[model samples]
Target chain A: MTRVGDVLARCRAEGRAALIGYLPVGYPDVPGSIEAMTAMVEAGVDIVEVGVPYSDPLMDGPVIQYAVETALAGGTRVDDVFTATAAVRDAGAPALVMTYWNLVMRRGVETFASDLAAGGGSGLITPDLIPDEAGDWIASSESHGLDRVFLVAPSSTSERLTRATSACRGFVYAASTMGVTGTRTSVGSAAEGLVARTRAVTDVPVCVGLGVSNGEQAADVARFADGVIVGSALVRCLTEAPTRADGIRALTDLTRELAEGVRARRSTPGGAPGGASGMVASA
Target chain B: MTTPGRFGDFGGRYVPEALIPALEQLDEVRRKAMIDPEFVGELERLHRTYTGRPSILTEVPRFAEHAGGARVILKREDLNHTGSHKINNVLGQALLTKRMGKKRIIAETGAGQHGVAAATAAALLGLDCVVYMGKVDTERQALNVARMRLLGAEVVAVENGSQTLKDAVNEALRDWVANVDDTHYVLGTVTGPHPFPEMVRDFHRVIGIEARAQVLDLVGRLPDVVLACVGGGSNAMGIFHRFLDDTGVRLVGLEAGGAGVTTGRHAARFSAGERGVLHGAFTYVMQDVDGQTVESHSVSAGLDYPSVGPEHSYLLDIGRAEYRPITDVDAMEAFRLLCRTEGIIPAIESAHALAGAIDVGRELGPEAVLLVNLSGRGDKDVHTAAQWFGLLDDAALQSAGAIASADATGVSSLTDGVQV
Candidate 1:
């Protein structure tokens, strides 16, 4: 499996932000979700974050929550996440598990990390777990050689950004907005400043997530970000599709557009390929 | 401050990163307010004047007969303004909102007690208030919706997830995250992130303190057992905190057992829950083997949550408190008994505790002294009770069905001639 850091570095080398697409494992159904995510990769998603659906997705907005609820109702299990991850990776994108912390803690951090690694996962995107409280996870990720990606939000202070990026191994997930994940008309105005603040503190790539739906928004974020993450929009594509084939088609089409969007700003004079500057700032 | 976000293996800030600074800020302010005499003084004065604090402990000989002849003492939190123990937590948090210089408060409620309390606090403090109530809860507790509007709170009926307290909390949290700059999420339970469980419990600690002294003063000794219904466990923690050191006072929490634990439809978390996280804390959550939270059922909307408070989980793990499940049938019977014997229309949530007290009294016989936290009045639940007991007249039944239909269609109208 491609390491998350390698994926980000490759994106930087190519002078384009990585297109990160999210879909919950077992959404619609286990096999179908895997197929859809694999299609996303085939269409140009650089990294795929397979959400392991939880009962209560507190941080999720209506779109992701609906997908997760459907996935949970369809009996999505922890093992299915690994299967989806491996499939997405096999389809050529590094797969990361984006899940609430409870699932990892319940499965035991070390065991979860090892299982994820075995399943071809390159990293984890923990939306809720902060670095200050991630001692065990940091240890587990290091031992398993899996990237530990933590979230930094618009509400984060510079001190918090420093703390978060310090523990990050792959890239820092920058939540563009303060609310739960959803597609909004306008990306939060605070996103650019937050990315700059986070970039000033670490060499880890900074990826902005939350509210980047269409290709245009993806391109807009890609100009300032090392990666642009799209979750609710992709999930919405699957949810709104009339059938499995249609869902996969819609997902791939959107992924292709987002790919173009990311690549569109690559040669722009101000759009630099530099990731976060200091490699060992947190250490 | 020692362990800001933990109760043993449970309780931590398991929220998205966006809320971390807010939680930290809230926690810091809470720490300061905890020691600041002025904050304490304001809270105390409000409790005395507005909330009718020092709620008396009334010994019920008549109700004791139903409790197998044990001396049953009641902590009258029902007499508090807004008619429940929820006022205790809301008033305290409202004060905190002021100290934080916030001008608005947002809260979520199930049966609407907390929403009403929050609305009351907001009204008194001249702050804007918004309450998120599940569509189902707003229908069932329509009076509370009206009451909140009267108190100048915008009651937004949430139509997500299970359409209950859990969903309301989700919406409220979303709102808080989006509006964190000037708004305080007046979380209505002893759950959520770091300071919430600790802070809400502290606000309610007055219950146990007052009841302990009042019980001792009236009965000449501490009760053998303290009983309180555990929904999110604020009241149980409120009454249980002061008696934790008593050693002899067996703290018992009664959970809503809708049908029964065996039927897989109850809210008895400790009985049938697995260790999982929900609503930001690692506690005993009623979840499936795959870790998806299962919807819990209860006759009482307040107790229909799938997870317990983190502190309750810790206490249960350490064997400091015993949790028991009481079925709807038993609880309703207790509810009627409280009304018939003691002239008290107790909330069904509180009746669950009365049911437990009955069992405890039976086990220990007449010598056992029990103090039950009467958490709230049954005013909000009267419509539910009327339907449950088949007490609704023909016109009332039709309107009740209409209300149910309205709730299903996302349209609620309390002024449609359906009298309580």
Candidate 2:
């Protein structure tokens, strides 16, 4: 099993969902972002998704887009992604790079995989690179011992869902809505259905993202998903903060709240265990 | 023919999973519509009755003087209903949107030509239309913006990234992703994922088809060369597709070179770009070493994009077509020449083709029959053109007036004095 799988398994054993947090690698600057991610881990984030700021982030909303523009304006490079990943790994969590396909393709898939592996990254969460166009990445991730996490949306056909789940190495990323990433007032009702559909296809842990921002939302997704992923809300902590310390403090507070929220499902009977393992045994 | 959704190694659906089913649905609908007689007849009727298809072919002998006496024929797509060839694809897509039972349509534009065309089609069909244009383009092409609003379409000025065509496309895709169930993204050009490149190209193939038949009827032969400006390559693909089988006819695409390719401030993707993915298709994209899209500059907003259509990249690889850069200065000069000599105010995007024709005409010399796709009219570009040639400045306008009056007096000395 991959490091991400191990974390999910541990969370399942603990009767809770894993808390996965995301921050672009160079939002405030390289070191500041790495510090923020490390703080997230310290505050109880089980997994760290190091976002690679891209020029055109199509699936991103205003919050993440603003953070990305700030990161890019600071001259963030691909090398900084690895640097932040390594720092997150050192801080005690499996780090995965969430990036657009062009950056990976530009760096050469095999080369990017090897470098990520060297930096102690566990997997990748490709927002744009679907399984239909992931041949090179699939082979390269396998050869380099890095997990490839592809996303499934509410719109995915059954055939596409099977293909995507069968190709996944770490876990399946189930986007909570049919929209770009943002902190919505309410996560879409479609997330639970998509997770269930994905579970029917594969035993891979299905993580829910796109709108899980606060504690209550985390608890809500934790009822069905194997992991709860938060991005824009966590990034907003840094974006709205007046200083680096305030950003780090806000990130820590949110991470703790989310971590507690995921565990809040533990006391509720049949809440968290109904995810990957339970679904497979019942099938 | 080559592979479904592929032109060589370039075209494919490289997008979010949410868009895959939408693309597949679009492809299926496009295929059925292409083969459906009723659908084809409806679109054709719309073209004949509405868009003014078989846009006339005009020969510019006076303009040919700058081209070393070569004969230049223009495929006047500018005379179409919305004042550009963009009407062809927008009308086709709008018809398809209705067929899909969609109630609304979204689109992205650079110079606002496609937006205007889409707005026009949507108004005719009673579908809600929203157009995303770069903030910079909305200001520069404010007339087209107003035209779209007047046509009952909402115009959104995208404010991210370079604030040009590329960013507008990004915003449009985001909207499509969220509203895919009810809205059809009437993509403006032959870029984007599968089906889009092929489908948009098919919608525009009438340009070459008509121009070819017209040349035969007028010049008694197919032209030796076909030329069109390559923005997202809709018009180029439109005029180049039918002539692909004609081995004797050469296809050349002129790309915008804002300053010069070497200056790193131009949109000449084929001139300096490498193989990369952008706006959903794997094609030639102008990007930094880390694969971040670089800003593409062009005086003409239509051609100011960081990437070209995927088929252009494939055609370049196989050498079936040739692409060259035309600097802003050269394009504007051609723009002035066409206005003065042919009474044609060509779009700046189309003027890139005119600039290229001048060079090719000079090279091929007098007997060569060159067909250039006059993709759109210059009505939307009056502001930019005025600023470009300093006509907007009172001092420069007065100086030009003085030079004109001095030249009218038939006194070279007085003209030089006016310049001094």
Provide the clash count, candidate 1.
1
Candidate number of the best TM-score: 1
Where does the lowest 10-residue lDDT sum fall in candidate 1 chain A? A274-283
Backbone clashes under 3 angstroms, per model: 1, 0
Give the alpha carbon lDDT tens digit for every residue of B161-269 in model 1: 7889888888898898889999999998899888889899999999999999998888899999999999999999999999999999999999999999999999999
Q: For residues B232-335, could you state the per-residue lDDT of candidate 2 as single tens digits?
A: 99999999999999989999999999999999989999989999999889999999999999999999999999999999998999999999999999999999
Which stretches in model 2 have alpha-carbon errors above 4 Å?
A: A266-272, A275-283, B1-3, B393-420
Please report how far candidate 1 places residue A171 from its true position, in Å.
Answer: 0.7
CA lDDT scores, all candidates in order: 0.87, 0.90
TM-score of 1: 0.96
Error of 2 at B208 (Å): 0.5
lDDT of 1 at B200: 94
Q: What is the lDDT of residue B266 in candidate 2?
A: 96
